[model samples]
Target: MDNNAILNVAHLNIKFGGIIALKDINFHVPRASITALIGPNGAGKTTVFNCLTGFYKGGPGSKLTLSSKNKSNNLVEMLGEGFKLQDFINPPAFVKRIYFKMFGGTHLVCRAGLARTFQNNRLFEEMSVVENLLVAQHMSLEKSLLKGVFQTKDYLESQERALDKAHDWLKFFKLDKRANDIAGELPYGEQKRLEIARAMCTSPELLCLDEPAAGLNPAESAELSELIIRLRDEHRISVLIIEHDMHLVMKIADHIVVLNYGEVLFDGTPAEVRNSSKVIDAYLGKE
Candidate 1:
């Protein structure tokens, strides 16, 4: 691992039955820098995010190591190399298993200081904006169920802190005025920003965004590009974005990686990628 690397992915492979999704993927997100993954549709970009978040477990030998606050976690290691449907026969055991998978699954990755947003806006539709943000901090907030149930000072302080953090992000995203509104009532662009804000409330070392610019207009995309840069420069958070918008990618990403057919097609800085003939050929549908 590089001294400044926050996330490292090596020997990553994912296959859906007979179909190859990602093959031997290797990359790293630099500390406090924005890295963009760009490729044509179905280039397996989102698959990488899915693998990183534990939604899709890659085959054996695949590894994703996240470094945060001087601690490192190998996501693949936390998830053992086995899947047993038999362990879920009993209802009580199955509920426990499901909770374990939910809490220790992506929560393990998130607790390791990584957070992610989906391609589609994933805000809690029925909850208020601030409430949605608060829910994202469930792991840290409810660390002590007894304290919360008794309404102890520590729990109240923690709740206040969580609410403060949520408001801070809402202010940053210019959604403070809408903090009391239902998340689904917001405009599509605002919902996208709210999702990112919710992720930020988790205080991740690295934030992974899957096509954040997907449904936004050009102006909104430009705002998102600026916000992403600010997240790296001001907040000191690393970002790994999977985006098809070349304009936004060039504007925000310090490093760019292009994938095609489950393989790395090109890896370079934004300027280098812009000048690479191979990248041009790949985008142009050439060999």
Candidate 2:
């Protein structure tokens, strides 16, 4: 792995009941840059995301490595032998049949500094808008369960830090005015912004977004683009975005990776992707 690469996906393959969704796909996302993943429907774009984020385990001989720029930790090796779906399901402990294999998936991935947002908004509908951001920052809290139970000084400090961080994000997204409003009660555009702010609260070195512009109107999409650019420029966080909006992708992406039939068809600058015959053929079909 090169020192410059923040994430490396090598020979990733995914299958479901003999249906191969991704075939030997490979790519690298560099640090402090915005990379775009674009493809037509059913091109395995989302499947690639699933593999990278640990939602789906890759097939045999597949590998994914992630490294951070500022940290000495080897996230690639720390991920510990790819993902296993069985590990994500927890069985009854009293039955004496509990399997550790069914209990240890990739929650560690997020802890290792990668975070993502889903294609659809996944907010806590009942929680206040500010609470959504606070929940995401739970990992950074300084207090332990024991400290909270005993009402220790650490618990008070952690509570204050969490609230301050939450307020910062709300203000950053211009949602401070609606901090107490329920997440579901906000307008659709505000909900989308809230999701981004929530992901930011995780303080990930690398952030992955799935079609953030899907349901947004042009104005909303423009705002979304600005927010993403702000993330890259102000926070110095690298981003991998899977989007179908060409205008948004072109405007914000420093590099573009195009996929067709679960394979890389083009990888270059946005202008290069726009001009490539292969990209046009994959998206528009031969004339």
Candidate 3:
């Protein structure tokens, strides 16, 4: 865990029965930089994201660690030694231990300042836009829950602060006009923006977005690209994006990691990746 790196994935491997999904992948996502993962379909890109986000654990020697200069200790170290992938992927004898570790992983990751949004827009359909943002701030609100239940003065103050912060993010995403609208009532593009806004409300040091431009029109995708760049330059949040949109990837990525058949075909700046023969072969195929 270097002071400069936000996320470090080393020797990661994932196997489903006899299928080798990912093999010996290693990459570092630097602090405050935007990195893009691009490859053809079935290239194990999403699997890598799953492993990083704790959705799926890797095999032996698969180590995923996150380090933040503002945080006191390494999140991986706190999780303890020998936190192997098999222990997480396969059912272990101690279900509770695994559960604790999984929750701890997410908590430490978020606490270490990381957030993410899925490819499919996930919102509280019944909740208002403001409610959705507020829900995403649960970690911050936890400190006041007990006090608030007792109607303590501090609880009221904390509630007000959380509301203000939520409002600020809504404004940041240009969703202030729909603050009281139900999340599900918003248009597709607005929902996508709300998802990003919700993740931003978490105050993450690093944000991982999965195919955010999937359903956007050309104009909307352009706006998404601008929003991503703004997040990097203005908010200073490191971003790791997994997208299939070449135009969007090229527009904002500081670096690119190209995968092919579960292996690293290329890793470099956007210009290098775009020019690589291997990337071309992987995506466009050889003549």
Candidate 4:
């Protein structure tokens, strides 16, 4: 693990029955930096995101560790993998593995300072924009049943705070005026921004975006590029993005990882990726 990395992936291997989807995939998202994962369609880019966000589990010896706020979590372990050799020697780790096996889930991953948006917009279509954002904060909110039924002061205050946070992000994304409108009613570009805003409301140290620029026009993609940079510089959030928009990736990525047939073909800066004959021949040439 890099001392400065917010997320570290080592020896990641995924299989759907006999088909090997990802083999020994490894990378790290540096703290407060933008890292881009680029590849052709069916290159297992989204599979990596699914694994990171806890939708899929890697095979044994595949470790996904998230480090932030002086705490570290083994995501694969949290998703119910048993003890490793190291855990046997480390008492705390051994106990945590037991706890995760009993109580761990995809929701736990979000609670562990990581949040993500899907490739397709996964907004609550029938819900209002503000409602969608508030829902994202549900895990962080206190859920005392008695207080909620009685409308206690503490419960009301917490709800108010959640709403304030929701609107804060809505305003940042320039969706404040549409806060009362249906999330599905918003324009496609605004819907994309809203989804990112919803993820931000979770207050994650690391944000994973799956092809955020997929449906945007050129101008919208340029704006997204600027917003991603701001997310790193202004909000101090590390981002891991899976994107096909080479222009957007080259413009904003501090580091790039190129994948082909579920294997890493290149890992370097934007300049190195641009200059690599292997990357050029494999994917960029087709572009």
Clashes of each: 0, 0, 1, 0
Q: Best-fitting candidate, measured by TM-score?
A: 4
The ten-residue window of minimal lDDT in model 1 covers: 77-86
TM-score per candidate, chains pooled:
0.90, 0.88, 0.88, 0.93
Query: CA RMSD for every model?
Result: 4.8, 5.3, 4.2, 2.4
Pairs of residues clashing in candidate 3: 113-205
| Highest lDDT scorer | 4
Better of 3 and 4 by TM-score: 4
Between candidates 1 and 4, name the one with more favorable lDDT.
4
Which parts of model 4 have CA positions greater than 4 angstroms off? Answer: 82-98, 284-287
Instruction: Please write out the lDDT profile of model 3 over residues 74-122, one tens digit for every residue.
Output: 4443343355555667666346455556565555566667788888888
lDDT of each: 0.87, 0.83, 0.83, 0.91
Q: Which residue pairs come into collision in candidate 2? A: none
Cα-lDDT of candidate 2: 0.83
At residue 65, candidate 2 shows an lDDT of 77
TM-score of 4: 0.93
